[model samples]
Each structure stands twice: as structure tokens, then as C-alpha cells.
Target: MEAFLAYTLVVAALCSYANSQLVPAIVTFGDSTVDVGNNDYLQTVFKANHPPYGQDFSNQEPTGRFCNGKLATDITAETLGFTTYAPAYLSPQASGKNLLVGANFASAGSGYDDSTAALSHVIPLSQQLQYFKEYQTKLASVAGSENASSIIKETLYLIGAGNSDFLQNYYINPFLNKHYTVDEYSSYLISIFSNFVKSLYGLGARRIGATSLAPTGCLPLARTIFGQHERGCVSSFNTDAQQFNKKINAAASQLQNQLPGLKIVIFDIFKPIYDLVANPKKYGFVEATKGCCGTGTVETTFVLCNQKSGTCSNATDLHHSKEASDHVSLKQFDVLRYQQAGRSRFLNDTDKAVNSHRLLNISKIPRRRNGYEHQENNSKFLQDGTMNIN
Candidate 1:
């Protein structure tokens, strides 16, 4: 009987140790880049819960992720030693004990600006925050008040925005562009980003990370439409993205200075993703300017790339482009017949880097509370307790 009691105690101790996570919880907010499946429940066309989407994920099933496999955030979670992902806020799985692990409030086709999400009838950033608040209440009910307070305070919050603001809204919306210049629109978005962070801080979030925009001009669809005549990256669009990154960096610093205990960092995805696009050979990607689906030129969303759509024999070797602008306001094109297109890798190599903390640079970020400043080439933030805002 004594031996039996000892065995039970040992088992209980082991279980308790295993339950202790790196940061207690991970909360995410963003667009399709980090959206797991929130859009699946929404009546939006910006979903990826179909074939060829998750062809490389475990179980070979689409989980509404926009990637061929695990998203960057998914890999980040795994790196942090999480066995299960944070359930999407709208999914049925986000209940009971699952709330303790945290929740994903991202929706595909959403952005920093609510107008951007409205263009596609998707959940806006403001709505996602409201959902997060609801999740917090449910979490407190499940974990109790004191435990839930610790979880919310220590949770690593990640947010991604801005991509759809430019690609899906401002570029196409004449009214938006006519009212504000591109720089002015970017400033407006940054103001929104600032308020969003402040709101999260008010709700007990301390650590946050934001991701910078990828090389938008190099995306296959962007190249096809804007750079068709040149067969090169649209310098104008990339310049806009670079300018936006600069503004975000400045904004992050200002936020850190203002928010007493907040630890914020901007993950530099621009350089890493651009490296993959510019020097595909360095990363073993043969074609960087085209996608693996359909004609490899456009075809991003569901209506564009169905099972009938000709997909490359191996998506592992190819990249996927951003969503096609098939909004009802614009004239739509006839769906293309199946055609064998060349494959090129996207985010695959970067996932490995993220696991090792190589490409996730937190350069030029001022660590105010840490009493140090990040150099222009440091990746120290990954080891530290800074969360990313995308």
C-alpha cells in the first residue's frame, strides 16, 4: 500500500511538470498568415479548408491554414513546446480546458483597417479583439480567477496585419486611394496598430510581437498584374512595404516607451522572405516568381484553385501566392483549365529557421525595460520574452 501511494505521487508530479509550458499560453491575432481556421466558420471566400491546401500537413488534411503545411506561428508554438495548437476562437474546439492554452482570433482577408476586411465580408480586427475578450472570460471560468490572471499576464500575444490592407483594399479601392496617398494610408494603419496594442495592454497583455510585410511585389500574383510588362518585382509596391516596415519599427519603439511593462518586438520577415525570393538557389527553390497552383501566375483563393485546378505534382518545392482579387466589385475572369505548372518553395525553409531562431531577427528594437538595445543584426529577442505583432 505504501509503494502504491509512492507510485501515484510520482505519476502526479510528472504530469504536473509536463503541464508547465514555456510561457503558460500563446494568444494570436492577425490575418490569413496566422489564421488557423476562423474563416472556415465565416461565410467568406477567403478560406482554405479544401484539397491541396494542407497536402503537406500531418494527416494530409486541410485545417483552414493558408500554407501547404504548418504555419510559421504553428512552428513557433511547437518551438515553445506546445503539443496542441491554440484553437481558433470561432471553432467548436475552443471550449473548456482548451481555453487555457489560448485562442487564435485571426481571420483570412482581414487587416489593420476594418475597411479592408469589409471588402471581403470577413471578421475585422476589432471583432477579433472582442472575441479575445470573450475567450478571456471563458478562460477565467475554466481556470478560475487567480490562475487566469497569471495566464493572461504572461501569455505571449502575436499579431499580424497590413498585408491585406494594401493588397486587397487600398490598391483596388479608388475611393481609398483618392482620399489618401499611399504614405498617408500607411500612417493611418500604423495609428490603428498603435491603438490595437494599447488596447491589448489594457486587457493585461504584456508581451507582443508584430511581423513586417513580406516583399509584396515579389508575390506571384502581384508580379503577374503589376510587373507583367517588366517580368520583375514591382519596385513601387516593395518600396511601400519597406516604408511601412520602418514606420512599424518606430511605432514599436514608441509603444515600448509608453507602456510601462510592455515588451514588444517587430519580427523582420521582409529580409528572410526576400532572401528566399531573390536567391532561390540559396534555398533550393527553382522558381520564385510563380506559384505551384493553376497557371502559377494568379489563382489564390477557393474559387480560383479547386481540386480541378492543375496543381504542381510537388507543392513542397513551390510557393503559394497571395489571394486573387476576384471581388464582386471587379470583373472576374474565367477559371483556367488544368495545366502543369512549375513548383517553387515558400516559407518552408523559413520554418526551419524559426525553429532554430535564425531568421526571426529582432533588429534595431529598443529593449527599454531590459536596459539594452538590439543591434542591427541581433536575433536575441527570440530567446527573450518578446511577442510578435504581425
Candidate 2:
């Protein structure tokens, strides 16, 4: 908890420079990675409103986030000095004054491809945009047209997609895989992403940040299904993710150049997450190949990782007694917490660059190279004790 607090403090301090929040509001759209609770309202099988899902969240109440506690975006909210999260757009909480701080239009299984969301009966990217338009009307009603316009122009827009496009759609859907090769599929997604950003720009958004795809093959579900006899991170899947990231990053740059007064940043989530997965011990985790809930091998969505599913114990405590050690079954959230802990290790320099320049325009920020590539050469803590951002 100390580490978490210290991490939070660093972020708070970064955004708190000049005695104000970085932006007036934050509007988010994407999949489960950023979905707060919109899936709870939807009649979809891809929900996370159950036990062990939000065990570390406030009041231990599941809020439809596919994790044990606050998401990285939740921490982003705190860092920006928002007293409350941008309420899920479909929730009752997203009305009146709540609309002023933006709304989360993300769904649990949605992605850049509308068909990806269709597979799970969740809201598609196009529908989420329609909801965003509706939200603008609501905001105008509450905050007035002029203030609403200002907020719309200044709000930090965030989008996290691509993961579901690959994991939930391409991998399983034979039709998709049969048609497009990896590069072709990624290019297709980039086209969708480009259009999405352009649509947002047209809707009065100026500043946007989109998350790059994580090392998808390293995910427990992927490891189980596709890791083959070697039982390791699938290099093919990771390569696909890297290629997609390259395309998206290029697409973001092109979009920025095409759209006047637009500032776009492709947040490099892949490297940090991959680093954590590769070197779990450096980030205070004992397990990296499985999730915390259920069998931890293949369970990810609602039914598989549900109330009946067995969760791993927090057995990696320093106490190391029989009681403590017996509980050792490391999982995803264990790594997530420590990933948060380790962010402070290198985020300081990165945050400084972002804070010093325009907060939203972080495209040119030169990040430190923490050596996950050479992790085997050193102990858990690198000689410099810094986490690298790729």
C-alpha cells in the first residue's frame, strides 16, 4: 500500500503542477481495459460484476472492471485530480453534473472492429460514438452550450482498443483469420482507428491519447491455448501485437499531421506491461503466466472467472511463514499491483517530460530504457533500480 500511495503521489504531483488539474475532463472509449461498468448495464456474457473482480476496489464491490482493483485509467483519474471517475455512460450515475467530468463509453468486449463487439453482444465502437454524441447533448443541457463546448475541446480523450480485436475476435473467428493475414488485419484495424480519431476530432476533440496493444500472447489465456508444447509466451502473437503498435503509432502521427491543432499520443502500454510479465519478480510478483481468479490458466471473462472460480491467495507476502507461503499462487492482479508500484521507478522522468511540455502531447517524450531484454543478467532490481518504458 505504501508503494501504491507513493506511486499515486508521484502522479498527483506531476499533474498538480501549477495548482490545477491537467484537463477539465477525460472522455474515454474502448474495451474492458478501460471499461469501468458499462458492461454491467448491458445484457452481455462479457461482464465482471462478481466476486474477486473488484476485491481490492472501494468497498470490495465489483464495478464491471476486469481486474481485482482500480484500472490504470482509474489511477489516471486520480492523478488528474478528479474527485470521482467519469461515470460509465450507461449507468444511472452518468447524468446531470456527472456529465461534466466526461463519461466512459467503453464496453467490456468491444474493439476497433464492430464485429468483434458483435461476437459478444456488447456495444460496438460505432455505437459508443453515438452515445458520446448523446453525452454531448446532456453536457450541453447541464453545463450550458458555451462551457460544454470549452469542456469538449479541452477534455482529454482516451481510447484503448486492439486487444479484443485480436484476442476475442481474430484468434477465435475462423472467418476473420482465414481472410486477412496478421499484417492485413492490423492494417484494417488501423483504418478503423484512424477513422475513430478523425470522428472524435470532428466532434470537437483536440487532445487524444490511445493505448498501444499489450503483449497479448503472454496473457494467461493465450499462453494456455496457443503456447504449444514449449508453454511459453507465443512469439507469433507478440509479433502481431508489435506490428499493430507500429501501425497505430504511425496512424496516430499521420492523423495529428492531417488534423490541425490536434495532439495525439499513443501511450506505450505494451512495453511496461510486457516488462512486468517478463520480469515479475522485479515488480514484486511471483506469478506472471496466469490470472488471479479461477484456475488462472484460461479463465478471463464472466463465467470462466466467476463466483464459483477459485482465486489465488496473496501468498507472496514478505512474512514467508507457513501460513503466508502456503497461499502462494501468483496471478495477473498480483503483477498489476506491483506494476503500479514500479511505475514510479521510471514514470517520474516520463511524467516530467509530459508535465513540462503539454500534458496531452507526449509523443516526443524520450523514455528511459529499463532492461527487460537483459533481465536474466541481473537480479530483480536492476543496478539503477529503474523500470524501463518502451
Candidate 3:
């Protein structure tokens, strides 16, 4: 833990220095992966602002983040030199100078599709966009219109969504399955993604970093639901996810060409997550199939992972699982480092490095806090190893 904190401090110092000359704020939009605490403000079953949810977070207090600690977005914000964590748009903390740092519009269970969000009573992409507009008004009121515009233009917009679209909606809904095939559904999602990016561009966003879909089929819930017979990852679900990821990547390329002054980069999460799941031992993960919370198979939202639930002592063991508790700890640090670098070439370089499976001497890091450990190791790796974020 001491080594982890030391690494965090070092990276924080470096990022702080770099951020003084680069990004001024970070605005995030997405599902639970980046949703800080917006779901807590909503009257929905999808909330994590309770005991056992933040067992490893600072002070071990539940802060509405689905994970036991900070989400990738939270760590990204810190890496960008924002001492203050981004507040949820609906939370009282998202006012005054706090608006200058930015606010999180992500909600647990949200996706590109509105119906998917409706199932979990989460804030849909459209509603989140409306909230973004509201946030602009509030920002303008706090800072002058000119300054607000500057912040909007310079802010690093991090977006991560669409997981729930497959996990909680399409795959489970036989009605939708009857209407759309996997390919059709993936294309449909790409259309929504394209429109969402265009809308953000219309809102004065320029530096946008969107994450591609992870290996959802490898999730514990996927294994339980679709792989129950075989006791393995659902290949069909993973194939769909890969297809969706490809479409999103293609859309990102086209959007970059079509939208002028838009700097959009799609971060590839599939490879890193799939690598961790497929080779858990290589990454020092003993349990990649299940989460640390309760049964770790199906514990998500309010029903599962509650205060009474039995949580694993180490939150880091969770992996590509579907339970909200299932999270890849390494992702938080690596993704944050990539975003903080603010370089387009970083994605390609990092993808190659991750695919090559280069070890980073991070085995000593604790599971729950491995994000920081990876961040620390990533800094060194990026400097001298195959990965180069600069």
C-alpha cells in the first residue's frame, strides 16, 4: 500500500505539471464504469452509495461508484491534476467552482440505447445530454460565458457506455432479439454512437476520448447466464461485443474525418480485459471469472452487493464479471494515464504494448489498489518500454 501511494504521488506530480499546460477540466459521460455517483441521486434500483460498495475507497465510504473504490473516470480526473473529484451533475456538490473542474453525467446501467437505461431506471444518454446542457448553463453562471466556453473546449471528455445495452437489454430481451440480429443491433448501436458524438461536438466538445466495449461475454454473469451449460465464457456474446467494437472504431474514424475540429480517440478496452480474463495468472489474478462481492456471479445494483452481502476481502480479484463488483483494477490506472497524456498515438502504441503482454513489475501491488500500482508501473513502462503515451 505504501508503494502504491508513493507511485500515485509521483504520477500525480507529473500529471499535475503536465496538466498545468494542457487540459483544464475533464467532463465524463457513460455507464457504471465511469459513473461516479450520479445513480445515487436518481430514484433507481441501480445505486452503489452504501456499505461494502466502497470498502477499499478512501476512508472506505460508499460514494455511489459501482466499484469498491474510484472508477476509471475518477482516477482519470485525478491524473489530469484535478485535486477535486468530479461531482455528479444532480448532486449538490456540482455547483459553483466545482463546475470548473467538471461533473459526471454517467449513471449505473445506462447505455447508448434509451430502453436499456429504462430497464434499470438509469439516466439515458439523451437525458444525460440534457444534463450536460444544464451543466453548461450552470457553468456559465459560475464562470463567465467566455470562460465556460473555454472550459468546454479544453475539457477532456471521457465517454464509456453500451455494456448494459447488451448485458441488461438486448441479450435478455427476446422481443428485441426477434426483431434484430446481432449484426443489425451492433450497427444500430453504432448509429447511436455516431449521433451521440455529433451531439457532443455540437455542444462545443473537442477533445473527446471514448472507450470501446470490453469483452462482455467473459463477464461472470455472462458465464452464468449464457455459459451455464459449459461453465465458460459465452463465445456468442463476446463475438457480438467484438463486432460492436469494430463498428464503433469504424464510426470513430469516419467521425474524425466528417466532424471538423473534433479530436476523437476510441480507446480499445477489449484486448486488455480479454487478456486479463484469458490469462489471469499472467496478470496475477487468481479469480477472473467472479467478483469479490457476495456470490460475485450476479450481484449488481441494489439487490446484490448490499451491506449484508459477503464481500471478498480484496476487491481487486474481480474481473470481466457482470456483477457491478467485477472490475479490472489495472484498467483504471492505464486508461487514466492514456487519457492524461492527451496524445492520439497513445492508443495505438498502448494497444500494441498490451497485446504483446509485456510485464511491468506490478505484482506487488494490492488487488483493490492495483489501479494506482499499474499507473505507477505504466509511467515507467510508457517511458522506456514498448508503450509510449507521450
lDDT of 2 by residue, 296-375 (tens): 65454432366766677631111001112111212222323534565344333333222223324334312222211122
Model 3 stretches astray by more than 4 angstroms: 1-20, 298-303, 316-390
Count clashing residue pairs in model 3: 1
- Put down candidate 3 lDDT per residue, 1-390, tens digits, no spaces: 111121232233223334545477777787877777888888888777777667778778988876666666655556556788878998999989988888889887888877888898989887888889999999999999999999898777777788788988889888677766778777766766777777777778876767777788887667766787565778888888878877887777766666666666565567667776788876556767775667776664333476665777655223322222223343433435644664343345333311212223322222212111112332312321112223
Better of 1 and 3 by TM-score: 3
Candidate 2 lands at a TM-score of 0.77
Q: What local lDDT score does residue 254 receive in model 1, on the 0 to 100 scale? A: 69
| Position 363, candidate 3: lDDT | 25
Per-candidate total of colliding backbone pairs: 17, 1, 1
